[model samples]
Target chain A: MIPYLIISPYIIFFLIFIAFPVLFSIFLTFNKWNIISPMQFSGFKNYIRLFQDALFFKSIYNTFIFLAINIPLQIVIALFLAEILNQKIKFRGFFRAAFFLPVVVSGVVVTILWQQLYGFDTGLLNRILVSLGFGRIGWLIDPKLAMPSIAIMATWKNVGLYIVLFLVGFQTVPKQYYEAADLEGASHWQKFFKITMPMINPTIFLVVILSTVGGFSLFIEPYILTGGGPLNSTLSAVLYIYKEGFFYYHMGYASTLGLFFALIIVSVVVIQKKFIEKEV
Target chain B: MKKTIIYTILIFGAIMFLYPFLLMITASIAPENEISKLTLLPSSISLNSYKQVFSKVPMGRAFINSLIVSSTITLGVLVFGSMVGYALSRLEFKGRNLVFYIIIFTMTLPFQITLIPQYIIMVKLGWVDTYLALIVPYLMNALGIIMFRQYFKAIPQDLIDAARIDGCGELRIIFRILWPNALPALVTVGIITFMGSWNEVLWPLIVIRDQNLMTMPQMVTLFVLGGRSEGQLGLKLASAVSLALPIAIAYMFFQKYFIQSIASTGIKG
Candidate 1:
């Protein structure tokens, strides 16, 4: 009774918000709703429509492209920064904090800030390029440039987090492994690949899955910066769902997409775990 | 010999990380014509954008709303999360593992799955456009419970045992004996909860329609994209800075706590 008493609020919230929404969301996939109108049964239409939805496929593809670019970029950069900062260094704490500054602010703030920076003619990047004897690059305007630009910004926003994670992982590793490597006349890259990499496999796996899941839910950046535009190039799966649900009020279809998106994410994480967790 | 290379690389990386923020601050303060210039240093500093943002928009209201929402949610999580966490950690009760497993499960469930249905829940309850819409659904965090549970488990059973022997009830034990010792966990969870609530955009954008009731991020997003800040680069940057600078400054001072929160929650991810 005492235990239940303490957890009752959570139990209530979980029932209403978590458990109910999950189950209700499934019910919603089979029905049509737009909130203002009555929910009409829609059967398998939403799922069937999803299979043929080019924009939906593009959104998912764009998200994967982001993950492909972001996760590796983030991991490599984070690991490098962590490797250097983990050693005896001046202002290590300050350096770590500097990289982490953007992580603390609102994503909207970061997205809006980068929107200004990624602006075509007025952007700092293009301005710098023109000044440096290079043609102006369309960081966000070009459909080809848009998703990758968002990916870079996403990496910038989140890599600090992975750096801290890798740092934590680095600390757990025994110094003797590196000491023995030094005695064996190992090169820098060799020690990192042999000693550091294998030891932090769990952290590596964790970073991959975190990035994958975070990548799957990319919204605010594209939502604010692009409106999933310039040929829907920046359309994220979650953003697509949001537009379908709120913007167009396609509640049932949005619910279907949400469920499908969640399924894709879970399967990916599970497969990723099986692939990586086994080695550990 | 190798130290110079590492230091130089680190300095370059630090500049890359901090450079945008310098421009944002400068652009927000720069006169209108200089706002679009790529220079980090503005030719002149003026508070015209800041003045416009305050007098013409409800920036202060959104800031206050964000403060009220974030702090309230944080306080709620600390109290409720700690209670349940302590109970699960200390109390021997039926269905304890069931409760713990549910939290672990909830931690894995993405918010997207719950997004539409939860909005429907809010709509059904007429919670849309209200503080209840903002605060109630997110008042308790599953991760906070897990953090507190893990933190509480590290305490010796004897401390709890002694507390019980001293006639401290479960609530008293958690609040008095346990909570003070759980300061680090408290701060970490508080930051996570507050930041999540503070930085939340999707739910607020979905639920909040009124500008006066908007959180800073939501209001700022609307203000920027809603054409109010059109061609007003200084004004837009000012609003972004207003939305960001407080939390960013806070992060600089207590970065350990902020970083610890992310590191701990990274395990959730």
Candidate 2:
């Protein structure tokens, strides 16, 4: 009885918040209901509509583009920063905190700040470029550049967490392996590729999976910066869901999108897990 | 020369990370005309933006609301999470593995999957635009439970056994014996929960419609989104600063713990 009492808070909240929501959302995927009206049973319609939805496909494509740009950029940059910070260097703590500063700030604030930075005429980046005798680019306004610009901001905002992850991974690599590599006259590049890379492969895999999941759920960045603007170039899966539910009041369709998005995320994560487990 | 090169790179990276914040602060304080100036430093300092933010919105109310919501959720998670963590790790209880697996499952599921339904539930409960809407649904974090369980598993069984021998009740044992030893884990969960709730915008945007009841991040975003502060770049930046200032200050003090918590828990998603 005492044990149950102790654990009851979590159980009750879980049932209400976590468990119920999961089951109810699955149920909601098949029903047509806005916030105001009665739920109408529409079997398979939402899913079928989702399949036929061009904007849904576009959002998926845009998300893939974001992942293509973000995941590689995040990995390389985080790995580089982590390697440097892992070395015996001055002000290591300061540098780590500096990199991590943006991660702790609100995503909305970061998006707003980047909105100004990405502004065309009087923005910081363009100011520097024009001074360097280069033409200004419409970062968030241009369809070609919008998603990548948001990707850059997303990378800046999130790479700190990955750097910390990689740093922790670096610490776990046994020093004896490095010492043995030194004894064998292995070059720095050879040692890194052979020893460091293999040892930290699990962490790399984790980062890949994490960044993939994050890239798909891109919302606040595009929501605030572009409003899914410039021909929906910055539209993301989550943003699409948000718009469908909140703006259009199509809660049923939004729930369907949410459910499908969840399935995609889970399947992608599971596939990555299996692939990484087999390889590493 | 190699050392110099490394230092230069590290310094440059630090600047890249820190420069936007510096820009935010300078822009927040810059005179209206100079808000968009392409300079590192503001030409003149003014508190007019800060004044405007306070006057235009219930910035103080939002800050207080955030504080109330974050602290309540943090406290709830820490206490309830530790209870579950202790039971799952130390106590011999029925359905232990099931509960643990449920937590792991919940952790894997993205918040979006449950978001619409959760909002509906909140609506059903008439929690919208109230503090309960912001607070209750977040009271128990699955990640917190997982983290606490991992931390509690490391604690030696002998200590718990010894406490039980002393006639301490299970709750007493948790609060008195195991919790002190789990300070690092406690701090980790506490900071993470507090930061998450403080910076949470999406849920609040969905559930909270009242201006006075809005969390700082939600309020700031709405303020900017409404185009009310359009062309008033300093005021907009000032609102951003107001939203960010508390977390930034907390981070400065708890920098080590923040990094330690994030690295150890790996809960960011």
Candidate 3:
């Protein structure tokens, strides 16, 4: 009946494992400490250094580039697939399951799949291009192409989850509305734009926020595929943070970068919420 | 005409989704030189790559490690998450609202932020490279608890009140009355947690260095990232396919549950 007594185990587990790490990470943000040496308090110096870090800015650029290229492509494909699946079609379950297969698979496998597909020499992408009478496109090698390549891989891995989300939203539209519009000679485009679009606008908004967050936090794809390569073109902010904290032992600086990233995510989410509120 | 167009589009897309796995399997069977050769079909079938990958890497150990770690985490989450969810939903407690909010807030903190600190904490406890490092920290998931709470709260109060008045203890009321009513939610949480633990790559990559301790995803990452010595194309594809097959099988069987389970949590605010 007592709260503390009943929930102590969960509370303790959370505090030690989750809460402690969070607070410790925050504390580490203000101090310079490698794993071996004693920590020194540096206050906002890590944050200031973060501003000067060119690689940091490049990663930020890359993260945004990933978001810009992938989000729209994913939304459009997901929305279209959702619409198609929502129709009373045959083999619906098969289609839905096939589409969602990637969501359950580990990110490593998907990354490997895409890596091999995008390989410079024996990769499927180059082979296809050469066969199609186009020259071999350097997918992961060229700095200009690396981020886009990462985005394409990301989009393939993620579109299924979004498609399912959109499908759920699409089902919420009353069938009667569509039937009524059908009687009035409304075209498919008219029905989609005039009715379905607005009805699923909220879901679209949710997907945007979720995918934007996902896009920004990307790591493994680029890490495994390019190793943040082609002069760090595919380097994501999270990957940079990972390197600073884990690889380089700049725990404090990584934390500051993380804090800045957290702030950006919060602000973007808030803006999205406000925009959604206005729409409603 | 419209139906044909839709079917064509969907079938093509399905192939795109399925193509990679098919190719990986075929490539795993094909000889190394044939990997670059322009052919969709394998010239000759051979299990030598699979044999090489399994022998060279600790494939058996990694698979078992993945199974052990993911299974333990899943069990922990199911038991603890359900208990927390039930308490948050049904138990008349003073700080229930606060606890609920706290859990929800933790969900927003990106894993990367806590990642280093968690590693540090695990290191301090001398848990690194041990299954304890992998299993202990992820035992209590905030999202799982919150979602379970949402599901459990939908159970009618009369049932609990009736159980209590029938002279049953609180624990009995939870196990007998509340839990069975919440099986759908539990299974949903279970599948998600299991898949999440199964598929998690980075944490294991960072925490566990021993090849014998590596999980499937972690092992795959090592190979994919060029950690293996041989770098044989067939062997790598075989490793990848081996990594993918079990989850793919599970996904096929639990397809419907997978959809409903994800949609229930994912679409919710």
The candidates' DockQ values read 0.76, 0.78, 0.63
Candidate 1, A146-193: lDDT as tens digits: 999999998998888899999989888899998999999999889988
Report model 3's TM-score to 2 decimal places: 0.96
Window of ten residues with lowest summed lDDT in model 2 chain A: A209-218
Q: How big an interface RMSD has model 3?
A: 2.0
Across A1-280, the per-residue lDDT of candidate 2 in tens digits comes to: 7778889988888889988988898888889999798889999999899999999889988988898899899989998888878889978999999999888898988998998889888888998899999999999888989999998898999899989999999889999999999999998778877988889988888888878888877887887888898899999988888898888878889989998888888888898889888987
Q: Clash pairs of candidate 1?
A: none
Q: Model 3 chain B, poorest ten-residue lDDT window?
A: B260-269
**What's the lDDT of the predicted structure labeled candidate 1?**
0.88
> Cα RMSD for candidate 3?
2.0
Where does candidate 3 stray beyond 4 Å?
Answer: B227-229, B267-269
Candidate 2, residues B138-241, lDDT tens digits: the string is 88888888888899999998998898899999888888998999999899999889998898888898898889899999889888988767667888889999
Cα lDDT for residue B30, model 2?
85
B-chain TM-score of model 1: 0.96
lDDT-better candidate, 2 vs 3: 2
> How would you encode candidate 1's per-residue C-alpha lDDT over B1-269 as one tens digit per residue?
79999999999999998888888998899888887774678888889999998877789999999999999999999999998888888888888999888998998897778899999999999999999999998888788888899999999989988989999999999999998898999998988888888888888999999888999999888888887876588888899999988788788778888889878787312
Name the better of 1 and 3 by DockQ.
Answer: 1
* Residue B226's lDDT in candidate 2: 88
CA displacement after TM-score superposition, residue A228 of candidate 3 (Å): 0.6
Q: What root-mean-square deviation over C-alphas does model 2 reach?
A: 1.4
